[model samples]
Target: MWKFYLFLLPIFGVNISGLYAKNDQKIILATYTYDTKDRIENLLPFADLLKSRFEGKFEIETKSFPSVDELILAMLKKEVDLVFISTAGFLSYIDQADEFEIAGTLMVDQESESTYRSIIAASKLSGINSWEDVKSKSKGLKISLVNENSTSGYLLPYLHFQQRGLTPFKDNFGLVEFTGNHKKSLDSILTGEFDLAAFGENDLQNLSGNEDLIHILWVSPAIPLGPVMVRKDMDKSISEVVEQNLLNLHQSYPAILESIKAGWIEAQNASHFEKLTKDFYIDFLK
Candidate 1:
């Protein structure tokens, strides 16, 4: 769904035919608002910050996409100027180097690690206690995942299962469902709708009150956090402005940063991605 953000100050009228011929005149800030709570908690503030930074120079609007492909397609069509996407989604566009560029990577906390893990959690009622039990006994159990494009929810778990000689959705599980987001997947597991679910470890932190109900079967090795990506054809000056605004966001907007887990830091480009792209898969796929 598309949500129009209203600015506190009046937006100056700029002729669309001149400086913004390609991007439909407005700079679209496309991000994945998978969790409903985040739409209010994290996204609203983040969008407000962008609007404040760009002001009248660029008419900025925020929109959410259902999947990674749609998000990338929006960039290809010049409908979206920037995207906040996952690491797995970013990797899918790495070969098309001329089209997309990394704006910056999201850092979750003061640690600024730029990394996270995939957590496999199961209900105690499911009788699955350990990773070995999951390997031997997941058949006929209802399973849930965020989505195919999710790094912790699906991608990392897929790679983990493959390494153990298991085919995730095809392995005759009672139900293999995509709940669209980690919160939903974890909730389903907690409510008895799913025997097991895979999601980001951060999502698990929210379920701290229900410790007696679920068991974390496994946690995958650390993986790089996703980066904010932008189209290459955007105005160079606009790109620089957006980049500088984000790098210094934490100091200016600590509350906003804390709302979204943490603030962002400069990304190390392709070399930083080597661990996720080359090492992570090579160790498993091979």
Candidate 2:
């Protein structure tokens, strides 16, 4: 009878293991990039580093979308466990604030904090100088933005107009257009297709030969950069593990550090986003 009971216990243990396997949870990491195919490939190094360091305790899957709004919707539905989003993308989902928590932020250029400037660049021929000069000369002109949801490209620059006592859509800010990416925005501005465009400081600094054709008309103050976040419903223990590993990734993998262009910083909560939100509002009211 004792042998029979021992055998039964083993059978029950197998059943439980099967059940757990069937319900195994998968972690989905989402990013906002139209070219997800390439982006995911680029992110593989970091993902592999996490897996190696964690010893495959968690499974990670990555997906990319074209816009922040789409990714936010996924987060709301609990379809994504984690995300890499820009400052503007973060703000767009502020109402669902409780749905997520920041896990980490990339420290690009060895800076503990990352900030972007809304640069108003114009072709040398355009002769654009100051903000007032841009306002006066840009009437009926063409302008390009990285995207409608872009912080430096759209939100900050739009708010800049309001600060100057002008309306973005109603005021004579010219035919506003979306260039899809910062490089494209710069291209449009340099090719004479658009008089000027807004870009992050990183993009401006990375520009090569075209630097001669394009000039910065104005620049906004530094604003918060990208953040890595996790869904609120995720396991706290797992989140902490992921965060700690990433924050220390540069120390572990020299290759990953070079590829990502920054080390991981400790994560912050919603309060970290408040300053960015306030900056947007102040710009909006302006």
Candidate 3:
């Protein structure tokens, strides 16, 4: 009887160990978009497909943050395994580039590669027509940026001004203010609270109904869009699995493909942002 009891103990321990291993292999994805609610609902089909394909190898979970800074904080603390961040957010840690690896990019359009421009817009009544026009009208003008941390909303425009030898506050670009979000920036411009605003071309298009109230005075050269990255210390095999899953998402889940208006593409190393280091567009707290 003693020998039989010892044998049963080993068999039960094996089952418990298997369950723990399953739980540990799960992956956590975090993003900073309000659209996360809709995205999650749309992603269910893809999630189910990945689970079926990966079997007991992995599981996927997601979370959302109101701002990219909050998402970055979570990543730094090892609370999230993967994240999707704007170019500016990624650039913030340019010096620590090796801390994460690019796994994939979201193709916003059907084209194999898509790029977006940065627009500097202002109320038509403000008479701002060009970058030069902005410099001339600087006396007591009010300006708004989507957020200090936004790539297109703040960094691009800020760097553009610097390159042209124009100092924002010193040259009197006006009272610099953060509108908190892109939509609000447009609203401020339309209502005359702000004489000028900066935002992504994509965001501008999304708010095109207000075209009569605002006008784009300038547009930046196309820049690389958003990227999905994983911690550098993550298990290589696990990262590879996530990469493959994303790349195959469109094929596996047609509904998700239509909803996001994008397909996944193979990702290259994200070291490309290194070139923009001199621009000082991104500021990583740590």
Candidate 4:
């Protein structure tokens, strides 16, 4: 698995302060999307930012993956050079030991604060108040989840249930459904079409005035927002250039930061992902 961050990461490599190397190759930059035009639009300017700094040497690209595995397949096929990917999507590709390294992490601000989080919520009508309630009543309640690729929407929530020996998949739940995205998942639960839903904390926050319609059952630990990823063998000069630009974006290029409501931070202090990664491989992925 990729270390995914660092002063230097234990498993991933970083060279922000190291000596540089120049490669003639034009660095490829891309972001993963779930067939959303909005996500494609958000990704469009990223290459422009790099191009401005690199004197027009970036190949702007975007890949739309219906699922996380497709993105991993693209990486395995060497079809991408750098990509913006969720923590779950990145770490789930366990065979990617040396092919890539985390170049940076996204932050909602200049500091380490990242608000990427998961929530397990119940319809007010569901009679489910907590994990214990869900466990005891798992057999008959319908549950909605965003697809498997989602970190805040699926992965962490899935692992949370798994840890307590309550596999929603095998518990004879009334219906286990993938709502495709967070908003739909919220919508399903809000209307009482589904008794439970798992999705991002921000999704509920974005849907104001609906608090009375839903009961909050659980919230996950802050998931590190997605990171910037690059090939491990990328030219040192290019890597340093990208890292420096990432570190400076909040200042030198505020619009880019604002576009995504997040800024790039140094690839440092990601030991938090270690346990998450380990548990995923040892427990969830199995």
Candidate 5:
């Protein structure tokens, strides 16, 4: 199981610093959706910040799971100390509330109250110029999608298609591939290997750094970003420090906040997640 877990992580690129916790107090930060080396790199500074904030009381290690289920398993087994999961993944795993607590939710920008979009992009050469070209009237276009468990990458797009009175597999697509990561889906479409790709809007910006590469097809409605969840049984002193630091990240470490697409919010306060159901993503979630 350990070997399989290690194998699930992508090849190393970022150098995660700090000495291993000597008192069995190491903090393992874990995630599953949209895993990439670049994302790891972006989180490195944040890890270092955590190390500094902990004042030698804890160490930080980052891990990537192969799926949301695996991540939940790790949490249940008390292996992963914390998690950065999507809203969809969070809703799915929060049923095990006995094992975890919401540390904080990621705020996508400096101004917004907390919402972001899933973007659909089409290759300029694909002749899919606008939303009209993607409507039910057009069919047989090849598309690449991120994992079914991805909120922005998969669920939002699925919901959009459903509301349009158009079915993805049954109506207007010749091929649909769940490529499992934003980079592959975006790269495939940009290289003309696929006609369309859907992923997080921020992910697209992070990948290209600009919009000149691909034509924007459509943008889904705003979706709430997930929270940073921590293992409930973790040491209270360490968990409190981690939670407080995470909530103050915007001011304490703006660069890290920028890297993860957050501004500022009271992550420790109680939040009302009034509606969450498999209904939003019934086909796969069920």
Candidate 6:
């Protein structure tokens, strides 16, 4: 029997002693990444631009990590004051932080009513023609997924499989590898290294990939991109300033949006991003 368990992963980051100690004049913001070596560097100019909005009241420091675990640990230690994290982390890891407060959602633009979705993709090498083929033969199937901390890449797809009676990489699939990011997951499929890949649909349209050789077996609902998170305990004035800037990023600070390839949007009809998370009950044989 399969269940849709709430996604809670174990910690994998090493403890950095005294990380919480920082200069009082500096604020730290972080994001998790894999293979985007320049992500941190790209964020620097954005941080500088954001700092400019603070009127010399404080400085912004941007950092990137290869693992969500490390990012979360930094948050726990109060070393990271703000974050641009994935939806999965927002849903499952919020309680891990004492002051986590969602400030805004990251969108393609202010007018992007709908966000990205997840897909179960297969490459030509899999010899799987369609959804039925995957459903019938997914057992022992070699699947490639992004890191466990990803929402579209892992969590949504995890529920998609369980709701349909298939739990790959846990009980049924032969091989399941974490490719680190959406592009890498897609790449793994194209290279014929796996029978299936689970990732965001946005990558299919935005990324330059051999789409002709891939087959879409399934697609999850519009799981919005990650949100901008801030520690509620942060200085009230600074927090208010950061929140306002993020909400108006597309219109007020287009340069920051251009640098990151996306802008922030206020949740159109909601006070928070509660709908972005899925409740699961998977029992992972612990």
Against the reference, the lDDT scores of all candidates come to 0.64, 0.64, 0.61, 0.65, 0.65, 0.65
lDDT of 5 by residue, 1-286 (tens): 2242233222321122322233465788887634533255556677877766554446789777777778778877878887877677877676565677777765444424433567888977688887778774357688888887777778778777777655655557888888887778888877889888888765675765546668987776556566677776665555665676677666656667766652211221222222223334333333
- List all candidate RMSDs to the true structure: 7.7, 8.7, 9.3, 7.7, 10.8, 11.2
Candidate with better TM-score, 1 vs 4: 4
lDDT of 2 at 227: 69
Model 3 lDDT per residue over 42-112, tens place = 44555555455445446667666777787777877777777766677777654544566677655444323
lDDT of model number 1: 0.64
TM-score of 3: 0.73
Flag regions of model 3 displaced more than 4 Å.
1-23, 34-39, 42-45, 108-115, 168-171, 206-212, 259-286
Ten contiguous residues with the weakest lDDT in model 1: 266-275
Off by over 4 Å in 6: 1-23, 108-115, 206-210, 262-286
Give the residue spans of candidate 2 off by over 4 A. 1-23, 34-38, 52-54, 108-116, 209-212, 262-286
- Judging by TM-score against the true structure, name the best candidate: 4
List pairs with backbone clashes in candidate 6.
3-282, 4-280, 4-281, 4-282, 5-280, 5-281, 5-282
Local accuracy of candidate 2 as per-residue lDDT tens digits, 1-286: 2243234333433222221224545667777764233256656677775554444555668787766788888887777877877667777776565677777655444333344567878877677756767767767677888887788888887777667765655367668888877778888878888887887776776776668898786788666566678776555555655565556555555566455442211121111221123344335434
lDDT of 1 by residue, 48-157 (tens): 66666555545677777766777766766767777777677776656344476777655434333533678888988888887688767767688899888777889888
TM-score of 2: 0.74
lDDT of 4 by residue, 89-200 (tens): 7777645655767766554433245446789999988988877888789889999999888877788888888887868575657789998888899999889999999988
Candidate 1 local Cα displacement, residue 58, angstroms: 2.4
Provide TM-scores for the models: 0.71, 0.74, 0.73, 0.77, 0.62, 0.74
lDDT of 2 at 113: 38
Candidate 6 per-residue lDDT over residues 1-286, each given as its tens digit = 0011101101212112212333377778898775555367646766875566553446678888777777888878777888877667766666554467777765433324454678888988889987678777777578989888877889888888887778645677778888887888888888888889998776787556577778888876566666678886665555655666666566655566555543222122222222122222112101
Count of clashing residue pairs in every prediction: 0, 2, 0, 4, 0, 7
Candidate 1 off by > 4 Å: 1-25, 35-55, 95-98, 108-116, 191-193, 253-286
Candidate 5, residue 176: CA error in Å?
1.0
What is the Cα root-mean-square deviation between model 3 and the actual structure? Answer: 9.3
